[model samples]
Target: MVNRHRGETALMVSGETLPMRLTLGALAELEHAFAVDSLPALGERFVEGRLSARDIIRIIAAGLRGAGRAIRDEDVAELSFDGGLNGVIKAAIALLEATFGEDDASRPPQPPA
Candidate 1:
């Protein structure tokens, strides 16, 4: 079962459903991949909305790994999804939204300081 509360989303490939998430570690990996200094920088980079084919692969791959699936970018590149490239793009965007969301309001409530 997919759990949005924990940032879990599903990716469909070859008629199979795979669970995906952008956990803390996965987000860190993305920061490194994008050569950003901090989480906010990474968010800025993504918000720019300029992504390549490889970028999409890296995202889906990391999301798979975040959900405990040992997968590689090469393998992800080979998979055929339902909506094809568009499907993968949608999944990636959804994953990003699930992680960072639209704005500060979308962020999780912070505890009392």
Candidate 2:
């Protein structure tokens, strides 16, 4: 069960739906992982959209931990996703949106006049 208002997302992995959140501790861990000094800086890094495959793994792993799961990046890599790579990426994106809320950049571009 996910509570979007509380910044919660769900991950479909190994035939199960796992709840994920970016709790303060989890966000701090991400900050350290990215070598960023502040939460905003971490957010900025994501905004840059220059993430590697490893970065995706780390983000999802942290989200799992945030939801109180004893999961690791390596463990996450081993799990099979419901919708494959696309699903995995969606889960990470959802976690980020839950934490930071969606912005204009995430929305579809409007047609030019």
Q: Which candidate is the best by lDDT?
A: 2
Per-model clash counts, in order, read 0, 0
C-alpha displacement of 39 in model 1, angstroms? 0.7
Please provide, for model 1 over 1-113, each residue's C-alpha lDDT reduced to its tens digit, 9 standing for 90 to 100: 67878888889999898989998899888988889989889888889999999999999999999999999889999999878999999999889888878555566989999
User: Which pairs of residues collide in model 1?
Assistant: none
Per-residue CA lDDT of model 2 for 61-102, tens digit only, reads: 999998999998999889899999999988988888778866
The whole-model lDDT of each prediction reads 0.89, 0.89
Error of 1 at 97 (Å): 0.2
Query: How much does candidate 2 score in TM-score?
Result: 0.87
What are the runs in model 1 whose C-alpha is more than 4 Å off?
Answer: 102-113
